[model samples]
Target chain A: MTNEEIRDFIQTAIAENRVMLFMKGTPEQPACGFSMRTSAALNALGVQYAALDILPDPRIRQELSAISNWPTIPQLFVDGELVGGCDIVTEMYESGELAQRVGVEQPQHEPEPPTAEAPQSAPLGVENRLS
Target chain B: MPTATELKERIESALPGSEANVEDLTGGGDHFRAEIVSDRFAGLSRIEQHRLVYDVFGTEIGGPIHALSLKTTTPEGQR
Candidate 1:
């Protein structure tokens, strides 16, 4: 496939998938501790979503970073839009916003205090061990 | 390198009383594996369950802690 075609293919993957997280690891193995947290947040929400692991190829990550300008793993995409990073998801969760976006309930019925979360910090903007 | 205790504490502090096991899976001080059980996951789907764990760490996910994998179960677990 031509370069443009390849790019289009990737775009299709993003656009067609309702929930996409371009993470470093799989849902079962998050490859990074932060990714694990992000993965957990989504799981807690109780939504069926697609997960793409960017660990298989350096070029895949490189191309995605170049195309999206997101220099980090665990990049989340909802309805094909780049929905910030891990911190962003956490923030949305606290505000009862991400649940709305993803079409699920807050699931915060736990007896413990709802420390839920709010977009904290994503090592995304930090220096990284580039793949 | 974060000890298993530190990892467990950090995870518990974030999610609270959540039945989780945080271990240094790689002995690299960075790689971790967390298997959590909680009522908070009662009705949520599989993907959603995983996201909650990642949300706690936020971006620190790929930072000081390099890799993290997860397995989440409801208080009742699989049917």
Candidate 2:
């Protein structure tokens, strides 16, 4: 697809999904540390989200940044709004705002600090239909 | 390769009355973490506040600057 088409595709994906993530790789096998931690936050919250891997096409990243005006990857969009990248997402998750925004109860158990490694528990029904 | 000092200077100069503490996270000069406090950030969402800092770098963000982890707060909100 051309750059214009890719941008449209990204915009549509964001509009269609209640919670959308544009990341470097799939949630199960993230290619970047930041992407891993961002997905982990959504996973830990048990929020079902649709994720798109931007690694497959450079244009996807280019157009995604254009559409979101966010320079980084692992961008989380809630209800068609940019929630932010890993740092903001992680901060919100730790503060319970992420769960609140996604309409989920913040898990009572303390979550281990986000590391490069994927969380041990499997993500709850993460949909990768955007690929 | 931009140094931590350069990043700090850029941010401080770009946003008047801002205090920025920048650290090279990996000692690689590319990845950094910056904590910024400025009245300019007042009433802005986290996304908007980060974008203000990001606009200072433009295309350089994903290019020469690989990553810039940010923590921003208004002067009154600083903890």
Candidate 3:
């Protein structure tokens, strides 16, 4: 598809889905760690979301990065606005901001917060660390 | 692939007076984690701050640099 067509496709998808994730794979079988963590955060919140796999077409990612100006996959959209990727989503999930943004009631249980102060530069667990 | 030091230098140079700490998360010279503190970030939202850093790499991002987990803040925001 041409860049214009891809842009249109992305715009339509965002408008059509209230909570959407442009990820590497489906929520059930995410291809990347960031995708997995973002999907997992949405699942943990029990919020319904639409997942589109970008692996089918390289143009999907190309167009997405161009339009979003965000050089990452696993991009989440809520109420038609870009929320963020795994790190931001995971942080929001921990802070209860995601639920608020999604307009969903928080689940009865919450995940435990980090217990120890980590090294400032340690890769956040949600990020990909594959060599 | 750009080394973590190279990426760090790029960021620090692009945002003058910024402090950048970059680490290769996987030692692969691809996936990286960057912690940046800059006075330039004072009024920007987290997203905007991140975008500034990202723009420095432009196409290198999502290409040679497969991932860059960013932690950006103003000096005042840093702990």
Candidate 4:
């Protein structure tokens, strides 16, 4: 597809999905730490969202940035507007604002806040299991 | 591979009157975490506030500067 077509595709996706995520990988298996955290936040909130993996094509990332004016991947869009990248999403998730925006109940159990450390711990836990 | 200090200087210089604390999260000089406080962010949404900082970097953000995690706030106590 031409660059123009790619941009059109992205714009349409944003307009169609109430909550859209343009990330490095799929929601089930995020390739980057930031992408993982962003997806986890949406998952924790239990909101339905459509995710597009930008890693498949460099142009996808380029076109996305062109449309959103956001430089990074793992950008979340709510109601066709840019919500933000990982930091903003995680902050909002913890503060209950994300839930309000999505119109869902923030989980009552208050799951552990997603942190950069959470991803690092997985490898350490794996090493410990091998020992 | 911009150092944390460089990132700090750039952000501070660009925003003027903004306080930016930057740390090289990986120590590799590519990934960084920055917390910024500025009057310039007073009336902006979180997204717009971040964009102000991001605009300073232009294309360097995802280029030489791999990732820049940010937390922006207004000096007036708004987040």
Which RMSD values do the candidates have, in order?
A: 13.3, 2.5, 7.6, 7.5
DockQ of each: 0.06, 0.92, 0.52, 0.83
Q: Write one digit per residue (lDDT tens) for candidate 3, span B1-79.
A: 7898999899999999999999999999999999999999888766687789889998888889999998887889841
Ranking, DockQ, top scorer first: 2, 4, 3, 1
The clash tally of candidate 1 reads 42
**Docking class for candidate 1:** incorrect
Model 1 segments beyond 4 Å from truth? A1-6, A110-131, B1-79
Question: Which parts of model 3 have CA positions greater than 4 angstroms off?
Answer: A1-3, A111-131
lDDT (10s digit) by residue, model 1, range A1-131: 34455455567768877877777676666776556666667776767677767775566665776676554577777887776566556656666777899888777664222232432222222112233
Per-residue lDDT of model 2, residues A57-78, tens digit only: 7888888898889998889999
Per residue, candidate 4 scores C-alpha lDDT tens digits across B1-79 of 6999999999999999999999999899999999999999987999999999999999999999999999998887797
RMSD of 2: 2.5
Q: Write the per-residue lDDT of candidate 4 for residues A22-98, one digit (tens) a residue.
A: 88766667899999899888877777888788886788888899889999988999999999999999999999999
lDDT of 1: 0.66
Q: Clashing pairs in model 4?
A: none
Query: In candidate 4, how many Å is residue A36 off?
Result: 0.3
lDDT string for model 3 (A21-112, tens) is: 88887676778888887877777776777778888778888888777879899899888888888777877888788889999776666675
Which of the numbered candidates is closest to the native, going by highest TM-score? 2
Candidate 2 chain A lowest-lDDT run of ten:
A122-131
TM-score of candidate 3 against the unseen true structure = 0.85
